[model samples]
Target: MKYRIIELSVLIIAVISVYAGLSYARQAAGGQTIQKGGLVADVRAKKIGDIVTILINENARASNNNATQTNKQNQLEATGDFGNSFLNNLSGGVSAQTQNQYRGSGQVSTSGTFTMQITASIIKVKEDGNFIIRGSREVETNGEKVVTVVEGVIRPGDISRDNTISSSKIADARIFHQGTGVSTQAHRPGLFTRILNWIF
Candidate 1:
């Protein structure tokens, strides 16, 4: 009986100690404990290892054009010659004209658009309340492989209640998309075309 009493007393003491420690920690952190939901989990990324879903919707376009023109002309004329050389009854006149012109024009235009969705990992947290995130994904279909990489800084307020943020809100963002394989090569220029392009 005495041994049972000792064991029970020890268990009680441990429980009380745990409760006190938890309460103190909660007060220090200014957080509330939800008994039903276990704990009120933060929906926002706060520290390293916390992940934020990134809604990636981006578009890009580029166009270029050039033109050049050149023109030149020259003329010469003379009169009242041979008045003193021959019989004075004959008149001489000379006229000459020269002209040169050049014209050149060129135009080139290109545009592209891309859209994707990716989940990023929070790699760092700054003192200024910024989260540095990096993410990458690769997909292969029909013998063609595509790779995408993204990294950037984000603010906590930009994160939605569902722990998602738009790619547009990311600052200093770097996103790269590339592909390889038969399909990619098919879309690219052939060997002859590439040779011509290199020569030009």
Candidate 2:
């Protein structure tokens, strides 16, 4: 009977201790206060692994024209009045004329524009609050695939309130756009042609 009473007392003590600990935690949580106006700032990417949207708006244009023309003419004439008998026959007239002309013209022009949006993950944070980011996106439509890749460093201040940044604002940026499909293949030279060009 005494051993049974001892076991019951120990069990009651354990239950009371658990209840006291729970009560203390609840009181501690309730006593904490939230500061006003502290949550008004927009969420921004500040840590490694955070994601940021990149707006791609790019345009390029180029043109060249070259023209050349050259012309030359030369004439030689000699006349001597030799009243003598044999020298007069040989000195009748001598004339020579030469002319040359050349003309060349060439022109080349190219223009392109790319616009899209992509998300990049911050891979590293610099000591000055800059971010190193890298990301890629691919889309397939009607058996055609287009791929875009971007990597660069960006300052935190450049990020907008919506946690987005323009691709042009990125420093030391590397961007690539590629397409693969039947159309692209048709535009490229054949394998045999390419090999022949390389050999020559």
Candidate 3:
């Protein structure tokens, strides 16, 4: 009976020691929370009011051309002779010739390209883990100003570790670019020219 009691006591002591060691280890770990995939959680721009870097490597090109031409020509000739008579001799045979021509041509061409970069901030976060961002940038030099604005939605997964995303990846995007200054004014027609064009 004593031998059995000794075995029971030793088993209880071993279990208690193991439990105490496990509890101490847990406490020593500082109660760190583990992510679903065992990855250390990071504070990324996944919420509203978060600032994100937008690597605006954007480029666009457009071109158009139109041409038209027309040409027309017409000619007519007629000659008449009266029956042999004195009247016919007095009034020489009648002759007539007529000609008409018309020509027209027109052409137009246009093309443009743009590239720029800007940073943006998150304005809202959707239930599906998407972010809505809006931002603008302006550059001025020598009295000339250029403004660029962008607004759109983006998926969190699209953002890189550095919290940057390409403008092309944005969804439902609205982008605008405008310029104003002496250079822009020089490209436009004068007031009188514009008035003439409108009148015509």
Clash number for each model:
0, 0, 0
Q: Write the per-residue lDDT of candidate 3 for residues 149-191, one digit (tens) a residue.
A: 8899999999877678888899998877666775555545556
Could you tell me every candidate's TM-score relative to the true structure? 0.47, 0.48, 0.47
lDDT of residue 63 for candidate 2: 64
lDDT of 2 by residue, 1-200 (tens): 99999999999999999999999998776655332233455677889999999998888565655565655667777678756645567644666776655555554444797788999999999898899999899998877776889999999999998899999999999887566765554445556655544543
Of 1 and 2, the candidate ranking higher by lDDT? 2
- Residue pairs with clashing backbones, model 2: none
Model 2: ten consecutive residues of lowest lDDT:
31-40
Write down the RMSD of all candidates, one decimal each.
Answer: 14.4, 13.4, 16.2
The 0-to-1 C-alpha lDDT of every candidate, in the order given, reads: 0.74, 0.79, 0.69
lDDT of 1: 0.74
lDDT of 3: 0.69
Candidate 3: misplaced stretches above 4 Å? 1-43, 62-115, 187-200
Candidates 1 and 3 compared by lDDT, better number: 1
- Extract clashing residue pairs from model 1: none
Instruction: Find the number of clashing residue pairs for candidate 2.
Output: 0
lDDT of residue 94 for candidate 3: 48
